[model samples]
Target: MNAKKEPSIWQGFKAFLMRGNVVDLAVAVVIGAAFTNIVNSVVKGLINPLVGAIGTQNLDHYSSCLSSSCKGDQGIHLMWGSVLGATLSFVITAAVVYFLMVLPMAKYLARVEARRKAREGTHEIIEVTELEVLKEIRDALIAQRGSVHDER
Candidate 1:
């Protein structure tokens, strides 16, 4: 009797690490972190300064006190400016990722799929021709066998 051996833990771990999804996720995380820095810089350097020209230099400073005093967390302070800044960062990041990465990747994948299908179509035609040749060979062999039997 033959028994199949199960893979070792190390082998399984290596396979998991080598998977395309794991590599893709790692790349995505790195790119996301880098993209975050760019978005933060845009908000802090460009957007904040433009907003500052109208009111304050930092959007985080723009808050409203719900109570009489908002000093040192004494009262309810609605920090709308920080929320605005975060929202802006998120919107910009999403837009950039969609337009630059997601859109291009989608188009590229479509092209690759089209090429694959085209190759498969050509392979199918070749297979059909091979089948026809095989059928003709089989028929010729049967005919020759019959002629030999008739001569006997």
Candidate 2:
């Protein structure tokens, strides 16, 4: 009797963690967290101050009262400035990642692919030339044998 054994939970978990994609994703997440700090700092340190020159120091404080009298712990306050600041941060992060990481990686991969194709093309040409040379050799051998038979 043949019994198929399913992987144990721990084995399955280990396999999942050992996958290349899983490790890559984990690395990306950690890098993204660190990158977020830089982006946040840029927003807070540079953008906030430049914006603060016009109004409040912090964008989070910029809001509007939906209802009358937005007093302590009361009324509907629309925090539009916070949203703007977050949006700016997201744009900056995306631009930095795209230009620095994604674009360069894509270009490098493209170059690698082009080089691989060129190598394959050269290999194919060599193969075709070899085949042609082999055919010529076979034809010459056949001619030599025919002439020898004629002399006999």
Candidate 3:
């Protein structure tokens, strides 16, 4: 009798970590973390200052008081400014990633696919033409053999 050995836990874990998607995901996470700093800096340095021209430079300070006697940590303070700041950061990040990276990559892939299809189409046309020529040659040979037999 023959038996197959099961994979050890260490081998299984190694295999999982060595997968292409796992490595790609890890890289994406690291890059995303680095990209986040850039986005945050842009928002704080540029966006906040521009918005500050209208009101406060810091969006976190902008808020509305709900309670009647509202003081420092006394009443209901709705920190809408922070929310707006976060929303802006997210928007900016998404726009940068989409325009700078995703959009260009998509366009490049599309062009490559189009070129590949064109090449395949040309090959198919050539193959069909060759087949047709072969069929004509076969018919001519057959006709010649019949004529030769008749002459005999």
Top-lDDT structure, candidate number: 3
Task: Give the per-residue lDDT digits (tens) of candidate 2, residues 1-152.
Answer: 89999999999999999999999999999999999999999998999999999998799988989998889769999999989998999999999999999999999999999999999999999999999999999999999999999999
Give model 2's TM-score versus the native structure.
0.85
Total residue pair clashes for candidate 3: 0
Q: Would you estimate the TM-scores of all the predictions?
A: 0.70, 0.85, 0.90
Please give, for residues 56-113, the per-residue lDDT of candidate 1 as tens digits. Answer: 9788889999998778868999999999999989998899899998999999999999
Cα-based lDDT at residue 100, candidate 3: 95
Per-residue lDDT tens digits for candidate 3, residues 1-152, read 77899999999999999999999999989999999999999999999999999999999999999999888989999999999999999999999999999999999999999999999999999999999999999999999999999999
How does residue 71 of candidate 1 score in lDDT? 82
Q: Please list the C-alpha lDDT of all candidates, in the order they appear.
A: 0.94, 0.96, 0.97
Model 1 clashing residue pairs (backbone): none
Once fitted onto the true fold, the runs of candidate 3 whose alpha carbons sit more than 4 angstroms away are none
After TM-score superposition, the amount by which residue 108's alpha carbon in candidate 1 deviates from its true location, in angstroms, is 1.7
TM-score-based ranking, best first? 3, 2, 1
